[model samples]
Target chain A: MSSIKPLVAVLCAGVLGLQGCASERSETALDQAAASFQAVKDDSNVLRSAPRDVIRAGESLARAERLSSYVGSGADVRHYAYLSQRYSEIAREHSNLVLNQERLAKLELERQRLQLALREAKLVSVQQQGKWLEAQIVSLATTQSDRGLVMTLGDVLFDTGQAELKNSASRTVLKLVQFLQLNPRRVVRIEGYTDSTGTPEDNLTLSRDRAQAVADMLVDLGVDEKRIQVEGYGDQYPIEANASERGRAQNRRVEIVFSDEKGHLGAPR
Target chain B: MALLALAGCATDPAPHEQMRLSEQALEQAKAVGATDEVAELKLAEDKLARARSNMASESYRDARLRAEQAELDARLAEARVLTLKSQEQLSLLQSRVNRLRKQLGEQQ
Candidate 1:
């Protein structure tokens, strides 16, 4: 009987020790849960964005606290504590999401406004550039009684016997595009002329191809194709005699004849 | 003895409703793109699996507690995923706004 009594006492002590350990663990969990709840409960942003979650966190913490007073309720206390901590975390995350969404909305509006402002600024700059280009074109042109305003593209703008305009022609072409854009009512006839070195048939085709190439470039640069006409005059009207290299070079030229601001292009020669 | 019996009766009802609720919460979290990569989601899945076994063994109280914790864990995982997505969007918008500001300054 004495031995049995000692065994029972030892067993009772072991049970008590286990209970003490469980309660200590539950106490730590409860403390952590309470701290988490406290942090979010007082935050106005959290409350505003996630009122339901904050309420749940508070309720869970209260349940954990109430269960902590009972013996053998350690597991229940810890379970509620875990729930309370999760609710607090969910509340904080929700608040952050809401705040971020608000910021995104404001930034989006600002971006749109800035985009509009930038577009307006670019248009104003283009208009200023158009005015400068118009002055340059006017100085480069000559007044002819029959052709109205005529500008000449020298033969150096293209390789010999090739209709393709060289890269150096981009500046002049861009200026012409700007001039046409500013004068929307005006039209131009692009005339291609070749020197007498090639056969008349070959010269005619080369002249047409050169004129068409220039027209294609103007259209690519945003000019309306309907505003321009192309013509090839094969060695028909030479400004210089085809005897010297310089004279032939002069003869192989493209001419742009502009209307008098009325959209009436001169007749093709 | 009657009070003890009542306490036991109260806890012995199988916790079928809590189990279903936990499962639903887990599914909802997964539907929101919460994978096992999320620590909370992994914990939720493991606990819910244990809760199911506890239910099979007639440990109703343990099953209920585990299911309840699992539901909250899954909910926290979903919330964290959404918060992370929002943070990414915030950074993207911030960079776009900064680019616009730089372009505007250059234009001036």
Candidate 2:
């Protein structure tokens, strides 16, 4: 086949040299070309379908038009037409693969964008709820020393020298739990601290007990068991100088810390 | 091959050509030893010798430091000689003033 092509090219060159470019090489093929494939040329299919077949068809048509000009110039010039057809087929195959890859890449990018958007939306919702709950923190630890939410105990939550929660304390804690439910993703650390006057060990024990009691209330309210961390500091870290009774009362309180992002505070039981 | 070629250029001077920069500094300082600067240079040189010996026994950091101190001493000896000449001129001027003061007192 390779040897035949050069021979045909030499013949055509010789013939064209004899006559001018306008002279017809043959009468039959000189008229016009009919569409090669009977398949309906669906334009939409070309744009929307795999680009391989359409591109191949296009290449075939171009080659045929070229060969139509050189019909009688050689015997079985159709071989060159076939080679050109192969080129179209190759183009079509590669183009289809590229299109499919592009489509898949776009879908994956869209999925990632949606996931990011969903995460941001959830974060916004949780932040809004935290801010709302912050408004509900009334009986907060009096002196604003550190950053975490400091809840004040309005005597309705506890009795003198008692680490147990009052019924009212339970009610307020339930409300807190509901607010926390809005952002259940974080773990809550419960700390109990007291005024500066008891046996160091006893105060430590009392603070611990009070913190645990609050944790218990939260647990019963369906908060995650693992998320509720309880610790007691006894009568140590006073918000104000423990020189006064008011300052001592101010120091006695419980604190809750939330440490997760998804608002799914529901640790396994 | 390259290292050998360069080694041929590496040569040490004769013993007398070996400059005792530290001792020379000491002598010039004695020539004008009234200046405290010369004493300070001698003290610094002594300290450097101590540092070098200590450094040679794997005390590399200390040895490098003592070598630096020795350089400072050599410079200090030269400064001391200059200071002594300046002081000598000042002393002669003071004596002239004292002699004039005695004349003034006797005539009065």
Candidate 3:
């Protein structure tokens, strides 16, 4: 009977000790997990975009609280609390990811919009400049061809039998220079033609000399020599009959052709 | 007496292997930027420090348990870092795709 009494005392002490240990088990981890879950729940983005994650986090927090409320299971409480904390973190990260994705999409759209606007602005500027250049060369008989802008200088600009340009042609040449300056990307080709009055060889030499003279003048006016191409067709491409004086006058001329923005001239068609 | 003490020393439960493993895990986690990205990494580091202190005080059993816990926490930190990094990479790729779609739409 005395031995039974000591065994009962020992059982009571063990029970009390278990109670004390359970009471002393820290609730800090569970409390922190609960707070983290609450913060995620309160965030509007998380609520709107991460409803499942928030729900899971809430469930995990509940599980952690249950584990902590139990007696003699401190390790279980800590394990569940860690899981709950991770779930809350995942909820927040998911919400942030969605928000950041949206922001990235918006930024990309804005970039594309700006790029399009810039392209359009550049195109409009080119069109307006073309129109202005066209107006400036009205007296020079400018025409748009597949080869690009063509400005023709009549025989009146040069001496009757010589290759020198007349002094009065300075105004037109200056205007051409201004157009070239405004559109610096464009290149020019100078082609000289003559009437069929002389031998083909003589006509070729004269035509070639006249084209070279014009190219030199352009180069002297600050145009890059590499950007100018000079060629003489002689009597090969006369626009009018060489039998009449008026036709011959029309045939003797110099043509200045402007290339495209990339300095590409279309082949003669 | 000395022989008995040597026998007791041989049975020391400080878990040197577990402590080394935990240290290695923590080093790997830190190398991957887990300390900055994962809150659990700091917790693991604290536990590891406690484990070392306990080993110094000759509390071998507690040191072994804490080392094991610390190793688990460090591994968790490594996993979380990978998850976050993958999420970031996915978002970046999605953004790039969005830009490509915009460009194709414009071209059409």
Winning model by TM-score: 1
| Sequence-dependent TM-score of model 1 | 0.60
lDDT of 2 at A52: 48
- lDDT, ranked from best to worst: 1, 3, 2
Q: Which candidate tops DockQ?
A: 1
Residue A79, candidate 1: Cα error in Å is 1.1
Worst ten-residue run, lDDT, model 3 chain A? A17-26
Q: Which tens-of-lDDT digit does each residue in A22-55 have in candidate 2?
A: 2233212222212322221343433354354445
User: DockQ of candidates 1 onward, in order?
Assistant: 0.32, 0.00, 0.02
Say which docking band candidate 2 falls in. Answer: incorrect
Ranking by TM-score: 1, 3, 2
* Range of the 10 consecutive residues with the lowest summed lDDT in candidate 3 chain B: B1-10
For A103-205, candidate 1 gives per-residue lDDT tens digits of: 8899889989989988877666755666787789989888899879999999999999999999999999988988998888999999999999979999999
lDDT of 2 at A83: 30
lDDT per prediction? 0.87, 0.53, 0.74
